[model samples]
Target: MHDAPLMLCAGEALTDMIYQGDERWVSRVGGSVWNVARALAVLGERTAFAGAISRDRFGDALWAASEAVGLDLRLLQRVERSPLLAIVEQGEPPRYFFIGDDSADLHFDPDVLPEYWSRDLRWAHFGGISLAREPLASNLVALAEKLKEQGVAISYDPNYRNLMDERYAPTLRSMAELADVIKVSDDDLRGLFPGVPLDEALRQLRAAAPSAFCLLTRGGQGASLFHGDQRADARAPAVAVVDTVGAGDASVAGLLHSLARHPGRSLQSHLHAALAAGSAACLQSGATPPPPAAMQQLFELLEGDAS
Candidate 1:
């Protein structure tokens, strides 16, 4: 019953082990929702991360990272288990081999969120593997439903990994219907709709989430935000990308930051900032976000373009 969090992120947080061959590996703390939470905190949002964090070394690193960015960690559950790990192969779309069975994040308990939290939560973000798993996914779905009832805005990112194919369609429809904002990448739509064209895929999404602001992130092609008859598109500036690990998460963070700070502004104005944040994240390695100064710089750049 503490002063309710303004923004709460619910989902998995794991380590990505980038195998560089010859027994070389680089590990970084990342998860779709985890990245958004960290990025939002970096962008000066009052955010809370509500997910199970293991007591293992990787978990320690993850917790420290969140704390470093000033994320409220009170809602994080600590457990005695190995954190989830992803063996990744860097490429155009990237490939991931997950090594998580009965992992700590999967054991997160939604009941731990106090009922009063819904009153003050302006926005709740959910996505990644959490919507594809068992008991945890169910917990997140229940939480989203309850938050919707409390009139809290819900933002969702369908960071589709191939592992969720079995239940992806139904889950996507459910989340699409519940979310106030839905962010998905070109890669996500490619997987969800297979041979369907991007425009048609977007149409499908709009039909599914009729009332939500639907965004499509298209890497170098930039991004588009659609809400009813209004539409805003921002083209990404050419930048030497270190790795696109958390670009979409950064985009979500930017969108949330805009919504929280400019509650009365148009989506078009907000999306300009979102595209900037996503592009900035691509310039750096790992799931890092642009600093507050850099974010303002980006917004200025977009304004310059508009003028």
Candidate 2:
């Protein structure tokens, strides 16, 4: 395993309103990249989060949660505005409703990045609504460019929120070119590429970003990994799903953790680990990530079964 920090997540930090069976709702700190960062931390990987949060109670909760999960918060910023919020709906196909505008997350300024932070990270992750918003989107793109120039591995998950304007596609595509690894859900790919077939969409995306290792996640079906001239697919194990929230983020974290722990492992093994992490997330409620031991056990079992 590489001793270097495995991941750096840069994006929005917000709260999610989760329905608790009854008419009541509970507030939980969540954001795509934030969830992934927390998952990575729980798996005993060195991880840091770089994003803007409000000075409000919600932001405090987010910070506390991040700290609890052992994610480095030196790069997190606090602003006067309130953080973003999302309402999650549970059904056959889960849905999300983003609430709030012009919040702290959209105000991220690249100049605020700490000068002392090392650029030698193994992976830097950015995406979600942060890639769909204004100054934050531009700021992340700039940061990704800088990280790429320094030869740092970049991971991106365009966790596309419907709240974003459709006009952001150009900017999203432009930033996609800078990522070394790109993770996307089937829903996100459909939204980004519209009526194109999955393979055709991937072909177009690969052409736009030739060097990226692409991962296409298909919810319960499984996920596929594409790198160089190779492609590998792994089926997600069946589990009693409590909520699908944060599943994709968990998968991203798992992929990063596996890569960090077993650097030269095959692509199939990496995809298997990611599937296990995501499946574990489905077994939990709210945006809470699965425990480290659970993730490891899932990976071991899946690998054994595959072998």
lDDT of 1 by residue, 36-142 (tens): 99999898888899999789899999999999999988888888877889888764557778888889988898776555655678899999988888788888998
Q: Residue 65, candidate 2: how far off, in angstroms?
A: 0.2
Give the 10-residue window scoring lowest on summed lDDT in candidate 1. 111-120
The alpha-carbon lDDT assigned to residue 287 of candidate 1 equals 82
Q: List the global CA lDDT of all models.
A: 0.85, 0.81
**Model 2 per-residue lDDT tens digits across residues 1-307:** 2333547889888888877787988888888888988988888878889888899889889989999988887778888886798887754466767776788888777786667474557789888888877777888888888887877888888876675556877866776788777888888877777788877877887776776778889876788988888889888887788888789999988887877788799999989888888888887886778777777778888888889
Global CA lDDT of candidate 2, please?
0.81
Those runs of model 1 whose alpha carbons end farther than 4 Å from true positions after fitting are: none
